[model samples]
Target: MATPNKENAPQHGTTGTAPLLLSRVAGNASAPEILIATMHGKEAVLAPALALLGFQVLLPVDYDTDALGTFSGDIRRPGTAFEAALEKARRACDATGVPRAVASEGSYRPSQSLFPGARNVELLAFVDRESGVEFVEYLTDVPTRFVKGRVPADPAAPETRALLAEIGWPAIRAMVVPNDPGEGVVLPEQVFKGIDHEAALAEAFRVCATHSDDGLVHLETDLRAHMNPTRMASVALVGTRLIERLRQEGYASAHPQFA
Candidate 1:
């Protein structure tokens, strides 16, 4: 999805201080607290946007984001990105007992237009329980870097090392899974912290190939915001869009007030 041209809509302005703005503008909307659920390390970028919009942002430590689906393509998530994001938001609402919450989900793969490369779609949803309204913002393109390759038998070979380097090795992690069919045994090794030695890649190769049909192990770019710079940047853009949607006063009239 491409980024939409943001026209200067009056309903989406945040100029005054938090307290002053809330008192004068958002008073009609119930719920003063907001929550953003993510395990993608998006907090660094998203928190500031919500703060500037006059909503207290909360992240419950117990939130299990993987339940929504992982980037490694394991445990296929149910429903579309919007459904998954809404599910995350509702869970946050349940955990914090807050009437307002936010959640985001991203999916990446080959572009429908252009085959066999990379394209990404990000969905950010704002749920106001008081208004029973869900305001969503989405973007495609997003400038992401994702790749897939077959693990080589000589994991320590120069060619294998070059592939890792291209994917931002230590900075971004990779997921190793069987390229065959059966049970998708995925072992996600955090190449970030320790062990740059080929031993790690060698071990990943052995595990995936053993279970695969063609004796091939698959590795792909981990799309987590913390791991992938491209994903983190996209989160920031989506957060800003969500904040703008939440700031709009007329959304209440657009949807029925719940509580």
Candidate 2:
């Protein structure tokens, strides 16, 4: 796939020594700063929870987390979800010289339950450099809007229309790829993501279908935190839980173990 466009990605770094507003949330001027390794607007959902512990959120400018993995299958994720999250947290600290960092990873799969659908599993990891400690929090069977289907190139077809309606297109966003990517790696031209409009979807279907051996396209929900509201909510839920866990462990009191 094409290299991620860093320029178009959201910028998160801030300048100066002035404390961020979140640092004052707990009325602590020296609130610890924690770098968030993300490019999908995750900091917004996680900041409030971290603020409870008098933690200030920091984001690295122009960092591309997609290199680790993507839901679209273009770049296969390495290792387990917890491992990926831990690596990202470490990478953030290494890149920005930040001693503390947090990162998250998400995965989706067919549900093995009685109901026939998919389930989302999200994991968050926090790393403290000084103490050489890493903490992981995760949630399984989280609610998701994930959906996938194989369809012909024709966007005007009834089946295509139905799938679009089911996914709530233009609102939830969608991604398109060749139904059969062949033995070789799928190229950037063969994948279309963040498609929200009918015209774009139609165009993506056409291009992706052209590359498929079966002359079909695979369409599914875009599960990125910024594109998918359902997944974002789940991230927030897990983030809240992580914060509560830290609180229960006496992190706010700076217990000797964590201190």
Candidate 3:
């Protein structure tokens, strides 16, 4: 991925000073903590926003978020994005014995508008077990580098190279699997993810083609938060929205009394 332009990054809050929202919640002797359920370093993108509200972001160890769902279709997501996110948040609390947690879920689909690419829908769920309150924030039609199609197992071919360029290969990662698999069961060996270099991409196409019935590989951009910069940006955007919603609901003002 291209280096993120730090100078142009969005500012979540003032540096070194507590925000007004933080002051409202400062009655508590200890800062409130919210666990972020993720294995893809989502806390880095989300933590700053919640920190603005005086929330100390926590990450659970050995959290397996992929059990909830995976972008590569190996494991199907169980429900709507909101449900998935809520479950992840709830599970995080249960695992870490924390009363509050947050989780993010993203869905991508072909754009139905004038645009020809994909659209990403990002959702963030915050659950406060202490208050028995759960809320979700989402942003739809977010931009993404997601692309998918079948191609022959030849990385040097013009069509293959064109497809790679379209997905911004070497910067954005790729995932490959056989275009057609019997019984819709894809084995671990047949699936190659996080392919960034040309050599790895070539090898993935070769391996997937061997498994494909028609000798075609199904290639797509890796949508993991750590793999896709665009998706990370979307997560940050939605996280900011979540913090805004919390402020609007006066969660800090209301919950500080209990703290």
User: TM-score per candidate, in order?
Assistant: 0.73, 0.81, 0.81
Error of 1 at 147 (Å): 1.1
Per-residue lDDT, model 1, residue 40, is 56
Q: How would you encode candidate 3's per-residue C-alpha lDDT over 74-175 as one tens digit per residue?
A: 777786777899999987776655678889998785334522453668889989888898999987777767888888789888878888889888788888
* Local accuracy of candidate 2 as per-residue lDDT tens digits, 1-259: 0123334333223335432121111113346667777888787788666755766555665567888977776777777677789999887776666677889988775434522453667788989877687888988878768788888788888888888888878688888888632224577677888998878988898788778878878888888888888888888878987888778756663755333
Q: What are the candidates' C-alpha RMSDs?
A: 10.4, 6.6, 9.1
**Clash totals for all candidate models:** 1, 0, 1
What's the best-to-worst order under TM-score? 2, 3, 1
Top candidate by lDDT: 3
**Model with the higher TM-score, candidate 1 or 3:** 3
lDDT of each: 0.61, 0.72, 0.73
- Residue-level lDDT of model 1, residues 1-259, one tens digit each, is 1111123211211223321111111222332456667655566687666655555445544367888876665556776777888998877665555677778888775345522343678788878777788767888777666766776645776666677777777576665666621235344441211224456767767766676668756666667777778778888887767766765754322334312
TM-score of 3: 0.81
Off by over 4 Å in 2: 1-29, 110-118, 180-184, 253-259
Looking at model 3, the pairs that clash are 1-171
The Cα RMSD in angstroms, rounded to one decimal, for candidate 1 relative to the true structure is: 10.4
